[model samples]
Target: MVMSLALISSCQWKKKSSKAMRRRRGGAPEIHLDLLIEILTRLPGRSLMRFKCVSKLWFSLIRSRCFSNHYLTVASPPRPPRRLYMSLVDHLECNSMAVCYNPRESALLLFTSSSSSSNNATSFDQDLTLPGMGGRNMKLLRGLILYIVCRRACIYNPTTRQSVTLPAVKSNIFAQEDYRKSVLYFFGHDPVLDQYKVVCIIVVSSKKIKRITSEHWVFVLEPGGSWKRIELDQPHIPTRLGLCINGVIYYLASTCMSDDIIVSFDVRSEEFKMIQGPPLVSAFKPIDFIEYGGKPSVFDHTRLRRKGLVELWVLEDAGEWSRKSLVLQPCQMHLVNKYTKWKVKGTTHNGEIIFAPLLLCSPYYILLYDVQKNDLRKVRIRGIPKHWFRKPDTNLFFYFEFMDDSESIMHLEI
Candidate 1:
């Protein structure tokens, strides 16, 4: 009887142990989907993109509306922002004309003020081989690099590492009749309509001076269609073509011997209209025209007593122009032993006018003009060594673009 009782007790203990083992080996408790989403939403965009491969649960959590909205809201900061700085790798010149950014590191480092020169710069090192000229007339726009090589135009996205080769435009429109003159190429995009266009303006010899003849071609990338030529009723040649803003392409054209006119091309309507510019002397010619803060502006550099005097003109209204001259002190002008040539390249970003003074000098620098306060600040970057111009790294280049205010700082959802 005692032996039977012991066996029964032993069987009860065995049943309890078997129950505990089943609990440990069988299905684990399920994680609440909402809690899992909250954890994944904090990951950076680059990491989030990779996390999609983990499992279907994680992918769905990342792609959900609630998580995406929260991720974007928490990621980017509020804006009425000023300047944005982007860093290019050392190999920017050889491998590609543009440098690709790692999405995780692209968060905007905003500045409190336009003049604030804090640590607002960022760097990129990934190399991309774009199909075109190795390096000439390269401009960064809307995550795409626009470049030209041997009269062929190309638009490449460094992030995607995808390139689209534009077909050769008819040479007659840009080719010279005398075969001695050189053709000039200009390209820009219409962001509103999502269209990219290239303008080829050729200078041909007339009587004693050169004359301008231009052809405008538009490239629609939505459906990957052929180039469409736009007809201009008049024969006005453009000196420079600025990017399209608000559905209009602004061109700086010299209509007369003594004046430069601001011309606007309506991409949707395919029509041309002209805006009057400030009066100019017979010898004065327009050197550069760029869009600043959504308005057309012009820059002119000329010799005054064997010194360079740069003047900036901003369009106030349809026919009004405001002129601000940057008087480079005698000491500021460096002498070029070679051709005695000095050129000023200017562009606008984040409501400020930035100009680079290029000459054969010991110190090469860039000048920033604050349009709001009408102030000037000279910024010098200390990387290029002496004799650097002769053996230019060909690898060093600058990339500029407007930051997307909506998604500038959003965190990546995984």
Candidate 2:
């Protein structure tokens, strides 16, 4: 009986050894390319980026534009996952005077969090850090974040940790005249043409005539990208950052006659349309122009903490306006401090408007208000460096955006 058991064990060992030898000798079972691609599309972007080194074929596949688009479609669902992107800058205090001491030493951290619902508490994971960039006024569109670094436009891909800097706009007016000039960049994606473009506006104001002259330039985000000049009949001063929705870039602007208007730019057609701005939206300097329920909506929360009610204006159609008032619950009113200033960062995919503090504090937290249910809650932000809170003389300046999870492995050029 013992000799029989020994023989059986030897046979089993030899069978397993033979299978291993076959795998080592390139006799492993083959998987179809399509099947492999399908399996890879379901993985997270970080994993797929690391898998690029598995083989030459994988490197090409993972980096291809086709694969990137497919992966985006697979990863993006109807509701999509929610992520928060933050750009923070620290200023040092010298003898009670606050100043940006060192741009190189300042930290620009991007944090990402995944949550199924907007009400649940979400924890952030520190994803990427760019030292000295000092990103300002960041705009996110289709998995790419556009920001300004020293007045130069930069597009960053968080998934692949890659960034591309666009050429600065050359202003002939600034070189020749003594006019005060400012440059602003707006990023948008054309769904019809499937292209990303940056709109650069240079506004030159002459005190002599009290006139403002503006020039518009467009640059597509592709290989060999160059700025092309576009003409506009009226020169308007942009008052806030551009909000792009459905291939249209919208922003509040003031005409040369001091009339406030909403300027809409078509990303694909490269055309500009002027719409008369609503009174409340134009009068408020810190008003938030956000996308609410798939339309361009103006969110006025200035009297939220004081009166416990907020006003929302939606652009129903061409030049048509609709307004609604949302009153917060009496129970949740404690979360808001009547003295502290709060700004509407953006909206979640579920249509909940997110409000964040304008001033930075040690334990940072954001509030979410559900217009439909009249519910409000706060979510605490974590993962900030302890030293930031420890230093009493440092002032933190930051901008945050809550967006759908749209990670991509796409490569950037030009």
Candidate number with greatest lDDT: 2
TM-score of each: 0.59, 0.83
Candidate number achieving the greatest TM-score relative to the actual structure:
2
User: Model 2, poorest ten-residue lDDT window?
Assistant: 91-100
Cα lDDT of all candidates, in order? Answer: 0.47, 0.74
Query: Any idea what lDDT model 1 has?
Result: 0.47
Q: Write the per-residue lDDT of candidate 1 for residues 151-188, one digit (tens) a residue.
A: 45555543223456666655454344542243444555
What is the Cα-based lDDT of residue 234 in candidate 2?
Answer: 87
Off by over 4 Å in 1: 1-134, 173-176, 179-192, 199-212, 255-259, 281-287, 301-311, 323-342, 360-363, 382-388, 392-414
**Candidate 2 per-residue C-alpha lDDT over 320-348 given as tens digits, one digit per residue, 9 for 90 to 100:** 98999888888888888987789887787
